[model samples]
Every structure is written in structure tokens, then in C-alpha cells.
Target: MNVLKRDMQLLKNSNDVVLARQKVRQWATELKFSLVDQTKLVTAASELARNALDHGKGGEMTMELLVNGSKSGLRLIFEDQGPGIADIQQALKDGFTTGNGMGLGLGGSKRLVNEFSIESEVGKGTKITVIRWK
Candidate 1:
């Protein structure tokens, strides 16, 4: 398996987001990810991509897809440059959303994947990782 990464500029417009997801889907298919795995991964990517635009106020985001050395599965890293998460714990609690939000996005996206983890700093940014097996 090979690893690939791309930088995304956060934009609220849906068309911009569609383009971003297309790039991710292309690379994911090139990696030969199984159909089921690809579906979940692509959905998760779309969610994160939208979050970057809607929540992060348009910032720089990095997307990385890797096939772990163990050869078991793929891991994806979606990182953004913004004011970072304010309340990490509250944010993870299902149905808790702050600002122009309908909630159920992140937590739901997390549940759709196998492994999910997040890191954030007050004034820095947020980095979220999700993985799915073959």
C-alpha cells in the first residue's frame, strides 16, 4: 500500500467541497481499497471536509491516507488550521454542537469508522484521525 496526502483550503461553498471529495475518492480508489471500506472512508472524508468549511471558518486542511505497515488497513488523517476545539469532551458527546450547527456530524462520522481519535489546542488547530480495516 502507498500513502498519499493533499492540502485543502477550507471553503463553505458545496462545489468546492465536492471537488475535494472527488480528489479523495480518486486516490482512495487508486489505493485499491475494498468497496465497503471505500464507502465508509469516503463518507467520513466528506463529513470532515464540510466541517473544515462550515466550522473552521475556512482554513488550511491536510488529508493523508496511509496503509499501515502491518498491511491490515488504511488510516486517514484530516487536519485543519483554525481556532482549535474549545471543548474537547463536550464536542464528543453525541448531539453536542456549538455555532451554526445541527450537531450529529462529527460524532456520527466517528461512529461510522473503525478507529477515531482527535487532538486540539486552544489557539492552534484540530487534527482528527480515522481508520478502517480490510
Candidate 2:
């Protein structure tokens, strides 16, 4: 197994989000991820990408392909310089949205992956990492 890293600069626009999702889908497919797994990863990518654009005002995502022995995984890290989340616990709660969205992005994306983590500062920024193994 080997390790590979890729990075994308996100922008305050929808097109960048779409491109991010497409990159995730490509990596998932190249890894031979199951259809269900690929879909889950892509869906989560879309949600987080949107969050980076809308909430973060702009951010970046790092995608890594990890291989260990017979197993493989995908890791994504989203970072932004926008105003960070005020209440992480409240933000993680279902139906908790600061915007007009349905408020399911973070929680739902967490459920779709094997690992999820978030760090944020009120005035600094935010960082989120998620991983899915195959």
C-alpha cells in the first residue's frame, strides 16, 4: 500500500464545490470503492464542499488516498478562514443550521463516513476532517 495526497483551493462559489465533489468521486472510483461507498463519499463531499463555500466563505480541501496492507481509505480535510462556528455541539446537532439550509450537512456527512472531526475558532477559522475506508 502507498500514500498519495492532493489539494484543492476552494472559492466562494458553487463551481468550486462541484469540482471538489467531482475530484472525490474520481478518487473513490480509482480506489475501486463499492458503489454504495462511492456514493456515500461523494454525497458527503458535496455537503462539506457546500459548507466550505457558504459558511466558510472560502476554504481548501486536502484529499488523501491511504493504503495499508489489504485495506484502503480516503481522507478529506476542509479548512477555511471565515468566521468559525460558535457552538460546535449545537452545530453538530441535527436540524441546527446557521443559514437557510436544512441543517443536515455536518451531522449527515459525519454519519456517512467512518471518521469525523471538527475544530473551529470564533474569529479565526474552522477545519473539518473525514475519512472513509474500503
Candidate 3:
């Protein structure tokens, strides 16, 4: 895979989440993603960014424009160094939440993208990667 561009932003607050959404939308538009596709990617990015901030205490988001043969995709990586999840399966289940959220962030994000993967350790951190193909 070849990365055309890469950008990283800090997810420290609610404003940062908004900025992350704007950045994702901008990259999706640059890649000529359709309106619906762009919305899906942006929504997923927002949720992940918020998770990094709220649940993880703070983290970072990385956006990459990728090219592989005839396929082009936007990939997002969210990483946080906080008290990590103890049960990823339960966290991924819809309607399961450790906070005040409705518990759709992880599962909903997965449904919005073409690819999704998550890794977390009990006391280490969490990293979630998602890709939206065009």
C-alpha cells in the first residue's frame, strides 16, 4: 500500500473532536468520496476521536490517504494511553457502554467503514484502525 498523505491531530477535548471530523471530511472530499461515504467516515472518525478523549483520557488521531492498485481509501488510526478496555468483545457489542454514551461508538464505527480493527491491553492503551474505501 502507498500512502499519498498523512495527518495527525491530538484528541484532547470536544473541540478537538470537531476538528477531527472536519479533517476527515476534508480528506474524504479530496479523495472524491461521495456525500454519503464522506458522512459515514466523518461520523466514525468523530466517535473514535471522542472515545480517545473521553474514555482514554486523551489520545491522537492519524488520517492517511492510501492507494493500492486501483483502489483508494482513507484510513484513520485512533490511539490512547489510558486505562485500556478489559473486555474488547463486550465493548464492541452494541448497547454496551462504560460511560454515559448510548454504547454505539465501536460497533457503529465498524459498520460505517470498510475495515475495522481494535487492540487494547488492560493497563496499557487502545488502538483502533478503520478504513473507508472509495
Each prediction's whole-model lDDT (CA): 0.71, 0.89, 0.96
RMSD of 1: 3.0
Task: Show where candidate 2 strays beyond 4 Å.
Answer: none
TM-score of 1: 0.75
Kindly report which residue stretches of model 3 are placed more than 4 angstroms away from their true locations once superposed: none
Write the number of the candidate with greater lDDT, choosing between 1 and 2: 2
The prediction achieving the highest TM-score against the true structure is: 3
lDDT of 2 at 127: 95
Ranking by TM-score: 3, 2, 1
State the lDDT of candidate 1 residue by residue for 1-134, as single tens digits. Answer: 66655445444567767876776677668778777767877788788778766666554434556556766455656666778898878888777887666677788779878889989887777888777665
Q: TM-scores for all candidates?
A: 0.75, 0.94, 0.98
lDDT of 2 at 22: 89
Using TM-score as the measure, name the better of candidate 2 and candidate 3: 3
For candidate 3, write residues 1-134 as lDDT tens digits.
Answer: 99999999999999999999999999999999999999999999999999999999999999999999999999999999999999999999999999999999899999999999999998999999999999
lDDT winner: 3
Q: Cα RMSD (Å) per model? A: 3.0, 1.5, 0.5
Model 2 scores worst on lDDT over the 10 consecutive residues at 3-12
Worst ten in a row by lDDT for model 3: 10-19
